[model samples]
Target: MAEFNSNCSTTSDQDDSIDIQQLMEDIDFDNVYSMEQEINEYETDQFNIMYNTDDDDDDDDDNGTIEKSVTLKPIEEQIKSEKLNPLSTTIVNTKKPMTLKYIQDEIEKIPDYLMKRNKVFKQLIYETLTTMSISTSTNNMEDLRKIAISIYKIMVIQTYQLLWAAYLKSGMRQLIIPSKTQRAYSTMLPIWPKEIKLLLQADKHVNENETYFNFINAQLHELDDQLKQNQMKLNIKANHFQGYTLSIQNIIETYIEQHLHCLRMEIEHKIELIQYDYHIQILKLEYLRHKPNTFQKQLMKELCHSKYEQETTEQEVNLLKQQITYYTSTNQSFECLPIAHNSLIDSIQNSQIRQQLFLQYKDVAKQSRAKIFALYMKTAKEQRDEYKNKHEINLKKMWDAYNSTSDNDKISSTMLDLMHQRCMKISEYIKCIYKFKSQSFVSNSKS
Candidate 1:
């Protein structure tokens, strides 16, 4: 019979048991051919055994062998072939990166002083521009542009300081790292090249020949002229309205006066009827009735004579005339009062007059408002000029302070630069922001 004994690397460890754990650990794709070879060899033995003594073979000799070399060279090669270039790795971003100024350009070599000066000026201009541009409308933004023109003299002086700082720093042999305070001034740093360009452009954009005050006055002239013309127009309107009101008031007064005169005359005539006319009629009737012979009796008869009828007739006639005059005058007064007041009220209520008055009032108000605005602009410009002058003076005062700290001026030197840069960048940002704000406002308004 054929011998069925099989040699295996890990098949002798257990009683008729093959450990799968050892197979998996020991086998890999690199050695799959070795495993197939072992399987074929086992099958060959099985076939031979079956032909020779298959019925006599015991279950104890039925163990299978597995050979896996665990060679991973092929897999390793595949992995190598699929590898990606390090530089080609995809980068994910949530938000776009903000633009930072090209600070490196300021320094051609390490420890370039221009870099520091650049930072300082950047800070100064940034602050100044921001101050100017924030919330400015197109109408108001012009002020910033004009104001930028006024900044030249100040700019020149600061430039001198930078040159001076450059000279001062030339004597230092130490590698400079600015202080914390100086670092704070970095916030005011301007992109010097960009700022200088913007400023020069803005400065030159305004005609070099135009005077500063002239620009200010030009802004004022149109507004002032309109105001003066409006004032004159308002003055005329006010005078006209005043005369109208007075005329109406006088007409009303005359009507009332005439009414009162009529009432007085009527009362006087009634009294005259009761007193003078009544007395005259009474005397005439007494004279007609008294004819007694004895003087004393005739006087008694005269005193007793009844003239009531005649007196009543005269009184009634005079009363009737007074009533007629009173009624006529009263009717005239009532008619005149209504006509006069209605005409006056009509004029008052008329839209033409009201509108004219309203327009005139607005004209007056507008004149004043415009004048105020003009004055405000003038004052603001003047104040700015004054402030700039004061700043120049302060700069001069700080010269000694600037000099006194020359040995340790990494801070002040940085401050001057930083402040200047803050001024410039702030100025430019202000201009941009103002322009954007104006465009947005106008767009919104149109919408």
Candidate 2:
């Protein structure tokens, strides 16, 4: 048991030693602590100027020159004044040797107020990096250095933005680049190293790129606004077109309807006139078909003349004498009655003969009256039946004409309605085509 316990203790110690080595290899605590200490020192202390060299302008030995000394109090005061008013700071000419310490000192010569601001900014950067570092598996030195440099570059860009704002607010037309040859009291020294120069060049390039991007964005926005305006105008135009089309269609339909109504009324009037003309022709044709012949008319006239002569002989004689005289004056001969007719007239004038003739005439009249009554009754019945049949036929003809006219009217009305429907459909199709064309045009314009 003692040997096993000893072996376990030895293994635990070896494991602890291995873990310590791994931890030491993974994280260089010394380097991190040292960097933090340098940052703190830089934050707290003011920059130191170690050496100053100026060319002497005195006449002495050819190889020898006098040293012009600078008072420390005045240098401190000047440096303080320069830190307070960076824009008014002037470049100082010196022959100072370039060194790492010298460069670092120059960079750390920021104003106290700016240094205070840097502390807060640095803390924020550290906090942000701490959060980002938690997600990563390992902290490679090179990767950490790159991340720090990138953060610093972003910070520098932000500082440049602030400086740019100040420059704009100052309303200065141009920025004068500092040079050794063009020294001025208001100008800064052109003593920055190659790295700072390169950084400044990069910032300038970034600013130019941003300016170009902004210009392009503004142009694109203008184009977009123009397109929207065009779309709105198109919409308004379409609306106006649609309204005009509808108004015109309404006008056309109203005119057509009015014209159709007038045409219908005219057709009805023409039909009535045609029916009246047809009825008049039918009456004229019936009168011609039933008209008396010339032979019958002559017989009726002779009977009436004979009845008149029997009723009044003296009036007949006087009328014949006038006719004879008129014929003689006209050089035309008159034909007298026959001998048998004269004997009959003399027999009628004798009383005895007239009495006998009267008895015979009475007998003949009674028999004839009976015969005439039978003929009159038969003719009257036949005429009444014929008249009834004619009336029925006329009524049937009139009913057939009315039905035919009504059917024609119905067919014409149906045809007119169909034409109207077709017209409406055509108009709707035209409207749809117009709409489709408008929509397609709009789509094409958009594309």
Candidate 3:
């Protein structure tokens, strides 16, 4: 009975050990399965994040409490499919090498807002290439090295091509045409070369690449030559414009001089007539003082019998009216003569006779003064009219000449506008060239 109890206990212990081993095996299997599922989910998330894609079904699955196991192909197969159908792929498989065209397309795909974001642009390119190298097969270092070299070459070529294309698109060609006739006159000066120099100073990366530096130096020389030619053309055009302006100025000056000369002559003629009239008045007054009676008798005879009798009578009446006006204006007595003329007479009868002779002489003097003044005014008006007519004729001639020159292709407005456009384009082109050159330098340094 004691032997039977001991054997039964050993058998039970053996069964317990077997059951425990089986349980351990089942737990290990479950853990491995759970780990695989987790890995699959992580990979799916990576794909969605890298490719910037989302699936509605995936979102629903993620939200659910239940977990599902997924079977996945090798990383290489997945990358190949992504490369073959890039648009359809939900992940960026960086194992594939990027072509020059691909790089160019990527650059073009960058938004305009991102173009000036130099750090961001460089970071994107760096991350893409680094990811590609990391994702490549470990056993294929040789292939990886080749791919890296190809990427460097692609970067250099793409940068150069982008800059060249920008230059072509710019209107630099308009500034320096091969044909002289087609060459335009630039009114605006370009500061692009100076701006490019400043850009180069700010970014020293391009100077590190010998090939890029050489190419840029050659282009700078070409651009300098083109700018010099444009400046020369502008100078010539400016000179021509100045010549026309000077000619117009000379015409205006000559017109002013002629008008002044006419005015001076008219003034001199009026002065001479006034001087002659004053001398005649002085001589008549002297004759009346020396021989008043004789002078009076002669004056009366001339006034009564001369062919200008009516004119003489009118002159006498005007002189008498002037004497009356002077007496009234000065508040003087009409019975007395003026003080300066009082010495010329002796008695009251003689004074009366002398005053009559003086009044007749004054009438002739007044008439001469009125005639001279009228003649002077008429001459002045004629001179003014002549000046105006001549000035109009000169102005018309100038206008005709200007219009004819402009219309007949002597002055080219289109050339001026084209040159201004070209100057602006050159500035833009310089900026693009500097930008790409700096990018190329950065890419090469990293490689």
Candidate 4:
């Protein structure tokens, strides 16, 4: 990294004032107005110098005046000049109308200060540039020269720019405080310059005790007058308040008395109401206490009945247990199917008897199924009759709604909606009928 010395060293106290004063004088009004023009001209000149092919050397023209052309010195000489004084490059006067001779004279003194103050910075930049110029990455001498020239130009321009900024800031400071000593302006800090040395430099703090004591004394007197006026106003207000106190007290007492009377009446009424409610509650409690307890008798009866049932269940359980013990003692096996009697089951198990019993069961089942079918048909007919009645009611309602509306469009839309609802109900009824038929078929197959 190429680090430029941004800390522009201050000159002697005498030269400092002269430089600041000279700079203030040299800052022409025209220069402020034509600042853009100056920048543009400087850029054009630099561009011309970079690519100008008319480098016919410095020659005398017909007017006997020497014409200056673009020229570059050898790198060794340039390095030597830099070592001697880096800012030795001719300062181009960007402004044409404003003469910069005074500026030049003032600037000429800066080199010594910079040299003495920034010796380390100079050595760093020199070493960096030297390393870069000699690096193997560079293609040729021309590139190295260009790089060195650009770096030097940048360093000088940045240094001057910083100095100019500091100058302007100090000038403005002096303008604001003309009593500021030249030594103060000279040692004033700059807007630029990021070096550690600049931070370490002590700044002179300007004592602000410039006749402010008189101003403070004047302000104190004004405040005392204001305090006195406020005291007078307060005394007048107190006198006025004292005059109003008796009437205000009477008004407050009357208002309090009125509100107290109203509160007393309201409290009496509330107390009466509360007492009446309390009496009513007492009567209700007495009545409830005297009322018949039939519900309690019923609960007792239910409890007694549950107890009897429980006792009977226990006795029955005991009897079953006794029977189970008797069977266990006889070594009889437990049957999964409940049969009324073993003898009856045995009788049915005989093949001829079993066939006869099966035929009898079939005949009974057929009779029961016929009765169930007849009942289902009767219920279905009743349901169909109810559906027809409901459909007629819905149609009557639709017609009523249609007649109630005078708008033809509303009638038509209402009719369409009603028809759609009717269609949906019909489809649902059909589906139910289909389900019933399917159930009948299933039952027949099962039989």
Candidate 5:
């Protein structure tokens, strides 16, 4: 049992030792990875500075000369050698004299090749050598060192490839030679390194990109505002057009209504004229049926004659004769004796006798005139009384006739009712026309 326990303890110790060794290997690998990352970062910063310096050199010839003078060939050659043998142990050890500053200067000499492959290469390199540092020994230290150097060389080669790729992408060779704006055009290319140093040194590129984006956004906003304004204008114009159309419609309706009203009034007037003419013709026919005298017929014919008919007929001559007869009859005096006495007195030559005769005649004439006046008044009163009695009787007869519903009376009443209805219809039509006109006026006023 003790032998079994001792064997288990020994196995446990070996396991613990293996675990410790694995832990140490893991630590060393982590350290080496971190160092590689730092070196890559440093190289990146150096390339960025080199790109920025190239840009500055484009602006000023003196700066360009100064940058060229500082360039070291030894470091450039060493970096080139490292690129050629990235995994070779001999190159890394042989190039041990190369410093960080020399490496930075050397980066400027190489053209950018892996311009868009930096991140991809970094990730691939990290993943490819997961267990890079596994053994821990005096002999393994050299191997470890070679591994570290090889990693550094790989980083350097990748950086050089990136620079070369950028240079190819820039199409610098395609630019027009002997052009004053060539330097400015070259600066516009997006082949520069994006490290922090270049970002800080070439702030103008960042500013220009930001400015371009801002300008685009502003233009979009302006276009949107213009669209909104155009829409509002269209709406306003549409409203105006609608209002104009309505006004035109209303005007047309008003004109139509007015024309119709004028036509109606003309038609009504013509109807009234025709009805008057018919009434006159009917009355003339009734008079003729009642056996009117020649004189009465002549008068009515003359009254009813048109202007042309009157000119051709004997109405003017008859009218003149009637006027002459009326004047002759009006001129005759009623007292014959007074006229004779006046003639006799005018014939007397003796003034006193003439005066005595005139006085006696005046007294006699005055007494006779009084008697005639009294007789005339009595006759006039009797005639007036007779006329009043006749009028009353006629009125009573008319009332009885009106009350009685005889065939003739009924016919007359029916005719009268029909005429009344016609008149009422005409009045109602006029009222309707007036109402329509008033309503139209009210609507127009509101509009």
Candidate 6:
């Protein structure tokens, strides 16, 4: 047997595999606005400076060899930002020598998710990988490298969440992205580098064990406060740690603490296409227990079942209406109903599908559910039995009472109208059951 690959991520976001959602978001999140914002700000500042400046010249045109002056402080600050990057300490993202204006464009198209709401979630996941590292960790370079790689996965997901939250807040949800752009639209979930980071960089090495735990707690406290203030309305899920064994290192811990986390969240399932907003705590346990494979299976089942019920019920109702017409055309002079009418209802009621329906209903209780299914099952047994039994009994009773003078065609026509009435009632029954079930589900949720 071929060995199965165990490297599949719970989310396509994790593995940089085929995350269609990420692909779609890539166009949106791709920082496309940095240059515009910067240009506008700079122009405004330039106008203000030019207006306020004093010029003393005996001859305005003749005395001037006019030159534009660039400020050293702002440029120096920008240079420092480019020099020492927090993301990559080794060499920085100097693939192209970018000015502040260039970086501004990156920020505009998409706000850096790594810089926003997702930071906390990334930290939590990173903490888990850190905890796991203790068990699988090696003192050697290779294991340290693997642990760093795992941390990158956590960071990538955090970036996705951050950018998504920023988009929601931007109120650009309905700006119809042109179809051509949408085809290239994918979410941006970039992996942090696999390089091992030194948590302590050029800080005085304090060999105090007590200081380490306290420092982590202090950083967590600060982050918690920021999240509570700025992120009162987001749900953030993270892999939970059992016991108090996990601890964060210095600067990495401090950097994460400064970024705010959102406690209120509007959660959406891509496959289920269902959405609801809830406090993060309410879904925290559920998120921790998330099994992607099982969720996909459950979503498939729900969609299939809903479609099957709708199609089959429509077919059955149409079949009954057609049967009313079929029986109407049978010989009128005989003044007799056909044996086929009773046989049809009886065969359908006893069929495998009907048995399955009964079994499906049998499992439901009237406690919290009050399922519409029970109503359907109860009605099927009663109405179907009535139709079959009456067809059998009335055929014999009417045959004995009637003479050849009776217009059997007219009588059958009356029966067809009656069947039409029953069909209407069945349609009403199906709708009412669905309405009742919806109300019950709402009530149950509130309770």
TM-score per candidate: 0.21, 0.14, 0.17, 0.19, 0.18, 0.15
Candidate 6 structure lDDT: 0.27
Q: What tens digits encode model 1's per-residue C-alpha lDDT throughout 1-447? A: 001111112222122323333322322223212222222222222221111111111122222221111111122122223321111112121221011122112111222111224454334334434554443344323332222222322222232333222222222211124577533211211111111222233364564223332332332443344435544544454354312233332432343344244223322322222222222222222222332223322222222111111121222233323323332342433223211222222345567754444334333332432333343334334433543454455445435444564443222453344334323332332233223323332333233
Error of 4 at 33 (Å): 99
Q: Cα lDDT for residue 419, model 1?
A: 33
Model 4 lDDT vs. the true structure?
0.30
> What is candidate 2's lDDT per residue for 60-176, written digit by digit as tens?
221121122111111122222322111111222232212223423432444231232455434433444454452222332223323333223233323233322322222221233
Per-residue error (Å), model 1, residue 107? 46
lDDT of 3 by residue, 341-390 (tens): 32223233665655654454334333432343343334334433543454
Candidate 3, RMSD to the unseen true structure: 56.3
lDDT of 5 by residue, 199-274 (tens): 2243555764344334334434443454455445544543543222433334323433443443344334323322
Ranked by TM-score, the better of candidates 4 and 6 is: 4
Residue range 193-260, candidate 4, lDDT tens digits: 11111222323353222222233334344434544554455445435432223343343234334423
lDDT of 5: 0.31
Full-model lDDT for every candidate? 0.28, 0.29, 0.30, 0.30, 0.31, 0.27
Worst 10 residues of 4 by lDDT: 1-10
- Point out the higher-scoring one by lDDT: 1 or 4: 4
Error of 2 at 220 (Å): 97
Looking at model 3, the pairs that clash are: none
lDDT (Cα, 0-100) at 322 in candidate 5: 33
Candidate 5 regions exceeding 4 Å error are 1-350, 405-447
- Local lDDT at 120 for model 2: 45
What tens digits encode model 6's per-residue C-alpha lDDT throughout 1-447?
Answer: 001111211231123223222222211111112222222222222211111111121223312222322111121122223321111112121121122233234323322334324555455445555555633223322332323333333333343344333322222222223376322213222111111001211123563223433433343444344434323222111122222122432333334334312211111111011111111111211222232233222222222222223322343333323322332233321112121122222344557754443233222211101222233234434444544454445434433323235443122332333222323333343333333323332333233
Query: What are the runs in model 4 whose C-alpha is more than 4 Å off?
Result: 1-352, 405-418, 425-447
Candidate 3: Cα lDDT at 12? 25
